[model samples]
Target: MDTVYSVVGLGKLGASMAAAIASRGFRVIGVDINRRAVEAVNAGQAPVQETGLEELIAANQKRLRATLDHHEAVLNSDVTFVVVPTPSDERGAFSLQYAAWAFRKIGYALKEKKGYHLVVLTSTVLPGSTRYGLLPILEKESGKRCGVDFGLCYSPEFIALGSVIRDFLNPDFTLIGEYDEKSGSLLESTYARILENNAPCYRMSFENAELAKIAVNTFVTMKITFANMLADLCERIPGGNIDAVTQALGADQRIGPKYLKGSLGYGGPCFPRDNIALSFFARAVDTAAELAETTDRINRALPAKIVEQLKPFFHKGATVAVLGLAYKPFSHVVEESQGIYLAKTLADIGFRVVGYDPLAAEPARIELRDQAVVLDSLEECLNQAEVVIIATPDPVFRRLTLADLQDRNVETVVDCWRILEKELKGHSIRYITIGQNINDEESQARLIKLWGNTDANSDT
Candidate 1:
């Protein structure tokens, strides 16, 4: 493609996109305020760590380059993609402090360019942010009209951190919130050229696109919460299995199998916060997002509830090993992780807790501090524990053999994902999960009394 692409921000997502776009035979320029990140990219190395990012950047160095000068990137490239941080505020709204600063830099660059430049905002924001929040800054700074001299589009990337390159290249659909027809069409064609797969694009106004981006994450959180709710119900029902219930529920076309599995609550950088931000937005519009509010409450309460469930399994002084400290497998991010909350609560309640993850050990250490020891070795964590919690559905933890726990003093195992059910069935260790009934006398007696023949007794 003749059009040069420039990505502002050299973070994981931005660096990955610059590399991916260059791989598709486009000359790409990356702009970042960090001098170290800029130097890293220009030296044929990845500015940040991600799956296959270093290799991809190294391979595409001839086509891709990075700079600290926004003017250099914008003046040289036809399209500039802004992917700066939109961190959550105290009230759950996305703070556009970083985005506004980045846009002002691009605005100065746009002032010098004579040709039409399409500036795309890929940062997550609420409705009216692009039109009402950012567009005015660009217009005032550049001293030019948007539709006439420059173009704008609010097109956020729907991608997970670990698999950003692949997800960006092959999305279910692309959403384009356009300032005008000219800008949106340019972006649509650019995506068509960049994407290996011919993904369909959904075009709309700026506000619609902004709302849609947050809505997708919020809706998925609700689905995850619903599945988690069923898991709690399964624990009380006779012969109840959450897996079976969700499987049947998923068979209906109205509900798909994705995110329907009953496990720990959803967490990461995005899902939990999106629900809160949407609720905040709803309140700003003078309405109540009761469902979202409830979902957030239930997810936040899971760690405490889980600790209560394990009260009978171990005493105060016993050591507990929490496997998989990251929010998900193949990722190092521990932001809003359920495993973090679980480990902290267990340690707070007087249990000595040690946690392990394949990628997130160092960051987990910083997050947990003295509350729980973050171990670098899974073997060490497994070896020094009386109880083990399979906190995430990591493949490494799933492949754990009975021999791995042989020399350990572990008396009980709580498998959140139920991956060890078959392996631990007849073992000497006590195996318990969230979804299935354990044939406990207390639960059975409680059910019997609740469903007793009250009418027959009253007649007598």
Candidate 2:
């Protein structure tokens, strides 16, 4: 029989895993320190708004449950998946405190349990995380030999927050790096039921798995940086559209399109932090990655790029509304989000910045604080601003029509996602978007359609 699965941190990744495992017909326990998070899950609700997640939870509510007690979660489940946060400190150091605390909690709990238990780590950690960071602590806590008494692996999960549930249920591949054959076999058996396509499960030593996760993100970061570099050049050259260039480049079989869209740089919790953490880890071992540093430098300049984009319309005391503060569409997480940083830069440069997001208003308010004004409605945001920039292309926001913008009294629409340009071409409102050619006439037409159409409603 498959063992009961417990997810220790009911955040985005953990909640999705808990729900996915339950959907796969396994007994799943969702555990978190946050009371609200636990209650939401226990009530058959998702803590975050993910596509198809509520339905999945509703379908498998009987198999999945949430709790605050860590000991109960550990003792009840045979295999425990740890998906806790390991965010960096103020000084940009990867804080190991959270991971260590979770490890100790799990280790101590395992000591009180009778049967065989396997701990799977889905959190991203620096290389040697399993051997140097977690192994000794687990051994010390449990007072047991590593392979003989229990099983463990640093099986880092590859999931984007916006699409985590979908990615968890249907990943391109699965990497399970175990410290021992027992851990590998145990995790493999558990994954067999979930990974229905029998996705390639590469099993190796713990260090390799840790490095693989870093490599995956690092490569993606580099790809985005490359695209952004092209975008910078495209901005300077007449009739140079970075979107066109990327599309043409993606036509080649070698560079099949993915993560090529050039925007305000890569954001979210993982890419920036993981890239830097990987660099730190490498530097600690006297092997600094120059390419990694370059990638970091390129991404760090994206906020400044937004400032430059606004320089053309830098009227004295101009107020700009930044729509969509989340790193991506369909997610509320704004850790190291480019939109927030862009708003901060604009605000610092004497441009009054107002921010609005469908789901990330609270998080953006907290992250940006007094630096930016977070408005309630998109119309209120658009009405108070001179230039409105759409940073995230949330499907909800993407479907917005010219009538919506007109009703909202929007003046200038800057689309970072390259949407709404074609739809609002006849409008008199100025339309500026990323990687697109925008002449004054086009901008005026956009403005007319958006702001000048006072009497016309829903009539293009």
Candidate 3:
């Protein structure tokens, strides 16, 4: 028999997962507290804005539906995936408040259901959260034995906001934290059917899977931080180029580079918080995650450091244009965005700031209210500034021509991602690529002083 899937919490990740599963010919029912989200799904629309989500949901409307009732979703589907938000608390640990409520509802629903069902947690939480914190709620509320009566698994998806659907369908590997062999095998089989790729499944105990999820994200953040440090070093070296260095580094079999781009600091909902959370968890366990802690601190300090570097360029009330308010490119999610941080920091330092994003203008406006003027178009932002800073590697920013940046008032172009290096290098404006040496003469003198002159042969 085909597995009927139910997804709780119709947020970006949950809704996309539901739509993706239904796209694979599975009957998927989604449950959410938001009436609008439920209505949107039923009306053949995406509840949240994600790349290819609305189209996917609309195409798979026949197989996908949503409801507000947890009982209905739990009773109907063979497997239920809890994808509710596990927001971080004061201590940097993910709060289980939302997940606990969702679990309680599912527990009550399970009491009335006849056959065996599997409850899968797809939320990011600290280790022992699933087996110790959440499982007891299910057992107590439902009044049923876990392994004998039903099953549970902690299987968080490795996905980003913009490409959730594609990532879901084509994950590098599936991490399943199962209660037992029966539960793990059931989910593994379901994933084999649903996933587009022949992805390997790593099944283990619940706690191990929970740790692995955060560990993956935290480790990636460390790699990103390491690259950002290299960018800092490159700026001081003669003939330094981050791309050249990273390209060579990536060729090494040991360091197959994905996040080795020595540009701006990494920011988004996941990368920043995951590192801090790992540090918090380490301290809680009477150990230390000093590397994770340092990574987070360095990333957080990046905006201020960049502002200090550009301080000399700022005059009394000089207008600075910040392009790309979203963390990376595409989509309109600005949570923990480094672009927003730059704008805010510049504004606080008495520079007149104007910010622009292709999609995240409104959210950036809300975030930068009165701190910086969030403009609708990149052209408008460029027109109002003496200095332009490309904070994200958005394709729109890359498409900017020499004509667009040729304003007499504009004196500098700080290309954090080096997108406009070739086009703007010899332009009238003082072009500064973050990871490249700006003072060539000074750098050369320092190198010659350190290593002695290569031009003159030394007597042996």
**Which stretches in model 2 have alpha-carbon errors above 4 Å?**
47-49, 90-93, 401-411, 425-427, 437-460
What global local distance difference test value does model 3 have? 0.92
The digit string of per-residue lDDT tens for model 1 on 76-128 reads 99999999999999999999999999999999988999889999999999999
- Count backbone overlaps in model 1: 0
RMSD of each: 1.7, 8.9, 1.9
Write out the backbone clash pairs for model 3: none
lDDT of each: 0.92, 0.83, 0.92
TM-score of 1: 0.97
- The per-residue C-alpha lDDT of model 1 at residue 182 equals 96
User: Which ten contiguous residues of candidate 3 have the minimum total lDDT?
Assistant: 451-460
lDDT of candidate model 2 versus the reference = 0.83
Clashing pairs in 1: none
Cα lDDT tens digits for candidate 2, 1-460 = 7679899998778888899989888999988889999888888889877777888888898999998888999999999999898887764556778888988988898788887889998888777877898888888998877788889988877888777887887787889889899999988877777765667788999988889988999999999888877876666555658889999998988887798987668888789976777778778889987888889987888888767866886577788888889988777888878888889999888889999998899989999899999998887887787777888887767887887777765677878877786787668777776766555465556667767858655676
Residue-wise C-alpha lDDT for candidate 3, range 1-460, written one tens digit per residue: 7789999999999999999999999999999999999999999998888999999999999999999999999999999999999998999999999999999999999998899999999999999999999999999999998998899999999998899999999999999999999999999998999999999999999989999999999888888888889988888898888888899998998887899999889888889999888998899889999999999999999999989987876677889999999988987989999999999999897889999999998899888889999988877888898999999999999998777778547888999999988888987888988889888788888887887856566586
